[model samples]
Target: MHERQDVRTILNRTTNTVASIRFHLILVAILAFPLISGCQNLKPLPDGLSLQGGEFPSSEVAFIADTSWIDENGQRQVEQALFDDLFRIIDKAQEVIVLDMFLYNDFQGPVPETTRPLAGELTNALIDKKKQQPDMLIVVITDPVNELYGGLQSPYFEQLEQAGIRVVVTDLRKLHDSNAVYSFFWRLLFKPFGNSAANTLPNPIGAGCVSIRSYLELLNFKANHRKVLIADHGSTYVGFVSSANPHDGSSAHRNAAIRFTGEAVADLLQSENAVLELSGHAPVEIDIPRDHVNATTSVQVVTEGKIEDVVLAEINRAAVGDKLDLMMFYLSDREVIAALKQAHERGAKLRLLLDPNKDAFGREKNGIPNRPVAHELTAAGIPIRWCSSMGEQCHSKMLLAQDDTGRNVIVTGSANFTRRNLDDYNLETDVVVRGHHSDSVFVAAHEYFEESWKNTDDRIYSLPYERYEDRSFWRRRLYRFMEWSGISTF
Candidate 1:
């Protein structure tokens, strides 16, 4: 009996040892997953993306701005022209219409009162157009955030689809992982257990609850940040790229956009088609006729990483006695910061009008990124000013460089000069327009900058840098770490 009992005990101990070994092996594989998979190549950049251009008549491109400012009595005032023009462009379309907007939902953050129903208005506009021209091809492409990565249903998307509009939700997995450390495990584990459109967890950005999967997917920290609208208007194709969103929470923000028609529209369509192909949709079949050219300015389409390339090149091209003016929402890209300092050192007079990074959907934010970055730039003697936002962001992303030789270069569109936006993690679109300083487009862009900078009217558009200056060493360290690690939302 004693011998039998000893054998039984040995067998039990052997079973426990095998189980322990299996567990450790599984753990090791999980830990090594990111290092192995994260370095793989991302999807090939779409054709005709980085660089495409032609000399276009200055009349073919027009600059438009939407300004939101506060009066001396603290009344919030808005002069909006961007969206009004967009609606008119949509109304005028006769054949093909393609829109790729990042935020197209009515996700009202804390301050719902401050927001206009931009999403509803935009949705109605598209639906109305589709109803008017049933055979006209209309495609809407957007990010998954609107649906909370399948955790919540988007009424706006549903309404559009019901109107026979094709909506394409971008496949973010096809893009490079911005937050590599978290994305590996998310792809391996969380993604397989897909999500439901029934709310089960509290929503991160707004009122309703979302699924656990939505929160899990949000940690990946990436998006399809492009906001573009292309359409066939009468005899020509018109294209618009802007930083504005059809989102209620962002309706009051100050923004900038440009309307253009020329051979560049063909390149813009091709760049957008790359997004469609990656998202598993067939490209729109439309031929944009190359219109007659009376070359008065050079216009080029630059997307994704190409924006960083063009911006840096333009900055490095600055010489003594040149002027550089930048207006941005976020300015935390390390390379851009370095380039700005170098330009300043080369005697290029630099003026930065930046958001204070203080208000977001009515919530007070500890000024990060912009504040620390502002500190760094100001310490180096570069001039900086804070947009006097009345609970609305100065959300324009534009860079205007004027050379002493009377040549001017204007870079503007959806990119915010941040790592995620410029490093190809998020899709971006910007047009570089080069012309003599006297060109109408250049004149309009300059007037927009000067009026806002100098407060030419009774409205208060921007304030002195000292109004929201931050010199906290710890915050600076924190911003540096976050920007390097790709963990924070810019």
Candidate 2:
């Protein structure tokens, strides 16, 4: 009888304690509801409006394209013009080389391949540069996804480090998480316990699956998407800003870049200082060559939202009889859409080449941002063409505009036309080249857009949007939600 009474007493006390704790938690949540709701109000970072993008020197520019396709003979052929330019710069660097690229890996996953050993080639180029100039400062900056959010080992980065190159992985934790809902739970449950566990699970991104712990960490989904190479060109500084990654899986994608030598070379170094300093590197002493204004083209290296502003300014300046062209991997920015629509309404001829957003590394995508945007544009009477992406992306961010005054402008570099990419969320760079219509880059810009749209030379580059048209109501809602809520992976 005595033992039974004691057991009853203990049970009652335990129940009371749990109830008390639960009541307190509920009260706390109620009291903190406003703060939780206001979590989306993240403080903004320093945007590029105040940043400096220098003037054009007496410099020359190059138009580089890497095209992959099935030829008339049904054989895989790739016309690589970017890598040659990259290696050419690496080979001639006399002082320092600062490279900030988003992806560098051999993780082909389930994507198609080219014969090119892209990752190895880039690693070798950097290593060779270091060997040639033993004291030259060579630094590399990349994203954490390349580490699979702490899953697989990065042999490429390790090789660079071993060769005395400084490699800094951007501290993602320092950046704001755009997905507020996932971020709330992540902060409460996942981040503190160490999301990366033992290496027993399969790496979802590697060619041959490797060890990992969780795929949950990857759901966070932000990246350092800038691709920049700044090195010495003769006695002056040269900059290469592009949409290309050294990832082997992406070797076959149609990509473009701009190489320029001028005062903007120092500006490129200055702009990258934000990334390097954010990643905990020391300050850089940019020994820039004096300005000798290049008459060929007026070049400026713009970063972040400044790219968006410049692109819009150039397009919006179009009068009747002008032309506006765009080719990009993803297109969902509302501002850009509005500008394109306005340009079309104002009688500027518009052509857009966009990815179908359909396939990614063996997995199918629902065509989030692009499809709905495409549908909207098509309804607005804008002509759109979808890239015939074999197993990769139409990973190019370019816009060519010819104003009424005959000023030809092309915006080309690493930025994709997305909210996350251009709105200060990711580090990005692009060179704005303004020249005469006869300039080489200006001419090539128009020709590239035309070739992709027309398929003139008995080659298939793009398909009509009707073939991949997605007009589902729910998908449009989902895309808008993802794009506006900052929960997208673009």
Candidate 3:
């Protein structure tokens, strides 16, 4: 009886201790929850403006189709025409130029005699223009992902800042859902510790007029993904619905961007200012044109989560009673597929070029069955091909369509054809350029598509190993694992 009483006392005391610990933990969590929530809701203000400058003249703008290439010396060059256009604009900047990009890199040569890198020349030209006109306002807005993914803290960003340019860095964690989760936990365990680390991470530019701000619209993940560069001389809009940052590596990535001139420039500037205000930046007065300027063409700007069903409607319109040439990085949207099929039944001749690694779903490893959209299209008798391994993956989002009457259109931008891209995730920016000039544009894009298609193998329908070489034990194991993941998109 005595031993039993002693055991009961010890057991009761231990239970009481555990209960106290649990209660304390709950209390701590309750207190921390508000802090975490507050951080997640960080809204600095100015709602969609990131920089300050006067609105550009809508009539003087022109749209351009930009290209990427590697020079003979192996330096990546973003379209030469783009650089030339920038030079012209910087020279004429009367008040301000606001530039926002996801990536920016300048490849200065080791020897003074070597021709300046594209970035270097552009930066120098801007600096010279600033020297000629001391009061010219210049502001640069860059995504914080540059700190991790690209070589951002280089001489380019530094030189721009040192030359009296105002630069703002968007809090990247607030832009994407995945980063929000990581940043929340990161701040929880290390509060001030993390802040200090961030401070010491090297600003390269000596931190001139730099501010960190949060974006509420971006928190939803379907916010702004459009890429625009605006200046007072003339504005240009280069839209790609992909991951081509304005950095050097992206200059080599297979991508497409369009430039605009005339009245379309004002619309692009307005959209860019909207993002800036959303990021808590000051707004500039914009001049809206009353009539279409230059050789007028119809252009539609489509953003995710804003329209009821513009994407589907556009696809349906383009695919119906037309010959379609599409170059896609990812294509998993079911409605798009249905519409394409319907179009085929309606007598549209379709040709497709898709990245083999990125199936209709996403990346496939080992021999796992991918949700290959190409297989379905091929079965339906659409002429579809995969890009070759030696070439860079076909990452451009383009749609070229022509009707029986020869009315042609080209839709290009940062948006992919995936469901997440079309409906949920912030992925693309597409502009439908329609006019008499579209025939030439469609022909150029079609030629590129045909070249890529001819180089790829047509047996992507077969299982991974059935068309490839012998696999190791681990490869076989990985294949089984992926097969069981139940994640194929097709």
User: Which candidate achieves the best TM-score against the true structure?
Assistant: 1
lDDT of 2 by residue, 361-468 (tens): 556788878999999999999999998766777888899888777788889998888887777667778888888898888887777777777764557778898989
TM-score for each predicted model, relative to the true structure: 0.94, 0.91, 0.65
* CA error at residue 78 for candidate 3, angstroms: 11
Which one wins on lDDT? 1
Each model's lDDT: 0.87, 0.80, 0.50
Please report, as a residue range, the 10-residue window in candidate 2 with the lowest summed lDDT.
Answer: 43-52
Shift of residue 255 alpha carbon in model 1, Å: 0.3
lDDT, model 2, position 211 = 37
Candidate 3: tens digits of C-alpha lDDT, residues 225-248:
444556654443222222344543
lDDT by residue (tens digit), candidate 1, 251-342: 99989988888888887898889889888899997888766688778678888888999899989999899999999999999999999999
For TM-score, candidate 1 versus 2, the one ahead is: 1
Which sequence of candidate numbers ranks them by lDDT, best first?
1, 2, 3
| Off by more than 4 A, model 2 | 1-13, 26-41, 44-52, 73-76, 193-197, 207-214, 290-296
**Residue runs of model 3 more than 4 Å from their true location after superposition:** 1-94, 105-122, 149-155, 172-225, 234-244, 294-296, 306-308, 318-320, 358-371, 389-391, 424-428, 437-490
Clashes of 1: 0
